[model samples]
Target chain A: MNAIIEVQDVSKSYGGVVANKRVSMTVQAGGITGLIGPNGSGKTTLFNSIVGYHPIDSGSIKFEGREISKMPVQSIARLGLIRTFQQTRIYAAMDCTQNMLISLPHRKMKFLDAFSKHGESDHAKAERLLEFVGLYEKRFLNAGSLSFGQQKLLEFAMALMNEPTGLLLDEPTAGINPTLINGLIDRLKRANREFGITLFIIEHNMRVIMNMADKIYCLAHGEMLAQGTPQEIQNDQRVVDAYLGTH
Target chain B: MNTKNIIFYVALLVLTAIAPFLFPDFRTQLATLWLMIVVAMTWDMTGGQMGYNSLGNILFYGTGMYVAAVISIGMVHDVGAYTDAGRLELMTFTERQYFVGAIVGIIGAGLFCSVTAIVVGYVTFGLRGPYFAIGTLGVAIAAGELVSNWGWIGGGQGISLPVYPGNFDVGKLFFYYLFAGTGVVLFMFLKWLYSTRFGAAINAIRDDEEKAEAMGIHTMRYKLTTWAMAAFFVGIVGGISGFQLIHFEPLETAYQTTNLGIFMVVCVLLGGKGTLWGPVIGAILFHFIKEVTWNYFLGWQWVALGALIVVTVVYFQDGVMGWLAHRKPQSPRL
Candidate 1:
């Protein structure tokens, strides 16, 4: 598999505490890639580094053959490298549609022309995507009113609205109910299969990542413990000892 | 605009047009009302839309006042002589000079204030929450002190504006129309602005800056742009109000923090911040209460104003617009 995202020897630290220690990984161009680690193992930090949420201490992060470590979050996002937060960072005050509309990476931004209405296509697309998230009936409801699980779905839908080249999802089902988790897993697979979009996911749940990832990278104590197919990673003694204990 | 909204706006315009003629005795008061509207509406851009509740908006208003005064003075006579006399009668002007000077002064002051906001924004927008609010407030107070000490623009003695060569009533009428027309134009523009993509983006910034940045909305550019727009309008209104005052003591009328600056912020809050009509409605109501308190309570008016602000804040925290937005789902107007 050709690497679409190359993180070669990247090391990030906070003060004297290293969060990512000379980490190296490659994501395939159009396949589901998983990063799983124990708590404080810097899974989220790695995701943040990739998406330009903050500057890394050292090393290079490239997206589709272009360096993106120094780029601003918005500019990085404009290039279709987008991410969703582990905690779900949606606009709760706005309706699902408005939240969807504002998430577009290519929305027109002319100061003078802001007075013009949003495009009908944007509204139609927002509706269609909300429907995709099983939120068609609640499109106009204030997103704050949505349940935690529904909010996650809304965030997923929001990310899709941007037509991202690669999507980095941080714990997409951390707090979701078991039934909804199954639905989300189905959608994630469909998103990868039908849309043909590259996905890099960080997750803690063994059952979920085991079922989904083409290849899994396990990080332990800010260091790469192992990398292989799900079955191999599951069998790999270091990864099992580090994280997948008894699972 | 839709036909219903069009008709509604036209009727509102006609009512405003007939306002002065209907209440000729209250023309000056009506003119002041319009100025208050401009002040509150401009303040809402930062305080309401962007959620950067700045106390230093008075900085732009006061600076615009002085900028317009100086430019108008320079137009009629040399700057030194105009400020040295500190008398409106001493500085005589032609009709051409008066109109030309006032127009240039208003527009020039607006440009200057916009630049000031952009410059100040780079430093101040980096700050968040109360740090930003207090930072702006400190700047405004410092600016007032700076202007008072500076000798060029009349120092603490203050300056007088150009005497209108036109009839006294026409002069009043002219400034009246100017402020009233400005009020109408500003209301419509803000109404349109808050409905657009730019408006949504700025509101998004107010809601969540980090999330907005993650969405690829450059929060800084939008914040600076909105602040500059707010400053430009305040600048124009400040410039025009200076000319209206004829003569103003620097600290009191032109840059009075308590009377004008804080009051503008309070007006936006009272009306219902973060909505299209909140500032407009808030300004009119605020102006009315202020006038009544000043007339009846006299020396205790400020006491009344403080109490009223408290009542508004404690009871109507979401603002009148926020309160009404919950009840009904109409756009723009009441």
Candidate 2:
């Protein structure tokens, strides 16, 4: 498969501290790509740069061969590259259905279109996605009232509603219950398989990433340390030493 | 609509229709109340819904007054000569001229203010939080000062519009209906708007700007659009106010930064920051208190208002609707 997202020698820093330094990676089309790193290893910074969340210090990031490092976050999103936050950002004041409806890509929506009624299909799809994420029963509830794990699930469902070409998930299962984690993993896989969505996930959960990702990239100290299949990554002495540690 | 809702709305409409006749002596006061409600609701559009608390919305109000006045006068007399304080009282407006000018001028003011909002918002929307508030307030303040010095538009003296062509009582009723009509339409518009995807987009922006952008919302566009819409209604009301007042100075009556400007913000805060009924309820409650204090307290009216604002902020920061929501958490809200 062709590379859907390509990052070349990208580096970013905040004031004196370096977040990412000359990071380079590729995510294949129609594949689950994993980004594994320790805390403050610049995994999120790399995702932010790739998705145009901030201006990078240096390097070219491409989505489907088109340079997007200079584009605004919304413009990048409109190009079908969407990202969820590490802490799960959602319209907490709105209900799950309203949140889902707002997630629809408004490519051709005019100012007056805001006054127009939402289509019935949009509601149906929103409900379908909410159901897919196991939040259908809670669809009528405000997102702020949801538990952390459930909020994360709602965020994931919101991302799916956008119908993006590639989804960059930042720690999707971090706050989730272990029992719900497996179900979320199953839903994520089904989304990839059925919806044909390419996922680039930043996860600290080794077992989940290793079991799910076709290929994994490891980072340490703001630089890439390893890139290989899940099997190869598990045995890599560098990843073992830096991430897993001898203990 | 439910029977209860229909009854409530019908009663409201009937009350509004007969309010001028019911309290003929309070026609001017009722008109001013509608003015307060309009400004407060418009202020909530950005302050409550979109998370941009602009303290300078009065900029549009003042500009609307000027634009409408100019348009009406310019259509008949040379605007410069008409605004010239030295001009003779011999310049008289026919009944036709008065009615035509009022209608066209009010509409022109609304459109003109919308354009100004888009232009001003392009620059101001870049600033976040307090900086945005200060930036917009500075704009309104600066406009007042600038207009005060500009001789072309009557400068510090300000312009005067022709009085309504009919009897004094009839005119009061006309202005009252004008304000009431605008307020009602704005209310209906917001009701519909808040139920749309556009409304959700703005609420998303209010919840979190960066996340909204990443979610594919063109936040700047939405912000500008919402402000312009708000400005449109504000401008229309300002035009009506100009015709009603007959004479207005730049700073005190038109801009009135410390008066109507701040009152709108206080009204929204008193009502609830982001609810449909909050601004309306808040404006009504605030208006009554203000009228009472101004009448009885006299010299200490400002102090009373200040105390009310302080109490509202300190004690009921969430306003009435928020307190109600907290007391009895409602099911999913859009």
Candidate 3:
């Protein structure tokens, strides 16, 4: 598979706490790659470093064969590498459609467009994305009113609206309802399959990660522990000992 | 536009059009009303929309005031002599000179403030939340002091503007209408802006700035744009007020940080910060309350202000607009 994102020996730390120690990983184009680790294994830190939320201390990251380790979040996002937060951060005061509208990162942001109604295509696309997330009826309602599960779905829809080439989602199913988890998994798969987008997901849920990802990498104590296909990682003795936290 | 909005705006236009003739006595008050609205609206741009509460907008106002006074007085009269004979108030200008000078001053003030906004925005927008507010407040005080010590613009004593060339009431009406026209334009423009991607982008910054940046918005650009827009309107309004007042005092009248500075912020909050109509309603209500209390209570006006602010802030914290937006009308059947 052609690699879309390449991280080579990246190291990041916060004042005596090494979060990601010489961590290197690759995400292939049009594929769902998963990162799983035990608590405080630097999973979120690695996600932040990859998506340019913060700078790494050492090493390089490449997006679609272009260097992006030094780029800011918005710059990376403009290049179609978007990431969603672990806690959903929808523009709460705005309605779902407005939230979707703002998520669009197209370059044509004229001031006069504020007065004009959203273009038919923009509205149609926003509506279609909302429906994809099962939020069609709540399109007009304020995002703050949505439940935690629903907010995550809105966030997912928001990311999709950007039409990104690569998406880095941090903990997409954490704190979501068990029932909604399946729906999220299906949407994630469809986004990858139908949209032809690459996904690098950091998940704590083993079942979801095992079910969705084509390949899995595990981290422990701020270091890579193992990487393999679902069945291989599930059966690996070290993975079971460190990450599963049980015999 | 929808029929409801169109009808509402037309009705508003009608009320404003007939206002000066209907109450000729209140033309001066009406002019003040328009100026107050501009202040509230500009303040709202920073305080409500961009989530950057600025205490130093008065710096632009004060600068524009002095700039207009200097330009108007310098025209058709010697600048040095005018400052020297300030106690006599003897300088004068031809009608054409005054109009030309005032027009130039107004446009110049807006341009000057917007340029200043770029410099100040770069410095202040870097600071977040309360630090930004305090930094701007410091800059504003320093600006007032700088002008206070500057001899060219008439140091501590202050400069005098030329007397109106024609009838006093007509002059008052002229300013009243000038202010009214710009107020309407500013209001409608903001109303227009509040609907666009520009509006959404700024609102996104206010809601979650980090997330807004991650969403591919250059947050600083929008923040600075909002600040510059506020500066443009406030600057013009200040220049107009300088001409209308016929006097320019440095600390008291021009900068007056303790008085008019705080009043603008209070007015925006009193109406609603982010919403378009909030500033208009807030300014109107605040001006009337101030006029009534100052007219009747004399030295006790502060007492009235304190009491009213407590009631409004405690009970109507969302301001009048937020309160109005929240209330649903009763069904006719019910």
Candidate 2 has a TM-score of 0.97
Error of 2 at A1 (Å): 1.2
Per-residue CA lDDT of model 3 for A1-247, tens digit only, reads 8999998999999999999999888999999999998999999998888789899999999998999999988788878888899988999988899999988765445544544656788899999999999999999888999998899899989999988899989899988999889999999999999998899999989899999999999998888889999999999899888955762
Clashing pairs in 3: A114-B195, A114-B196
Residue B312, candidate 3: C-alpha displacement in angstroms: 3.4
> Per-residue alpha-carbon lDDT of model 1 for B1-334, expressed as tens digits?
7899789989999988888888888888999999888989988898888889898898888899999888877876888766764455455888888888899999999999999999999999989999999999888888888888777788887877766776888777888898998898898888778878888888788888788877777788888999998899888988988888888766887778878888888788888888778888898999999999999999999899999989887887777787787777654234
Q: Answer with 2 or 3, whichever has the higher lDDT.
A: 2
Candidate with better lDDT, 1 vs 2: 2
Where's the lowest-lDDT run of ten residues in candidate 1 chain B?
B82-91
Per-residue C-alpha lDDT of model 3 across residues B58-101, encoded as one tens digit per residue:
98898888777777666667776777743476556778998999
Question: Sorted by DockQ, highest first, which candidate order results?
Answer: 2, 1, 3
Candidate 2 iRMSD, 1 decimal: 1.2
Which segments of model 1 are wrong by more than 4 Å? Answer: A107-115, A244-247, B1-4, B85-91, B327-334
lDDT of 2 by residue, B149-248 (tens): 9888999999978888879999999999999999999999998898888888888889989888897888999999999999999999999999999999
Best by lDDT: 2
CA deviation > 4 Å runs, candidate 2: A108-112, A244-247, B331-334
User: What CAPRI-style quality would you assign to candidate 3?
Assistant: medium
Q: What's each prediction's clash count?
A: 0, 0, 2
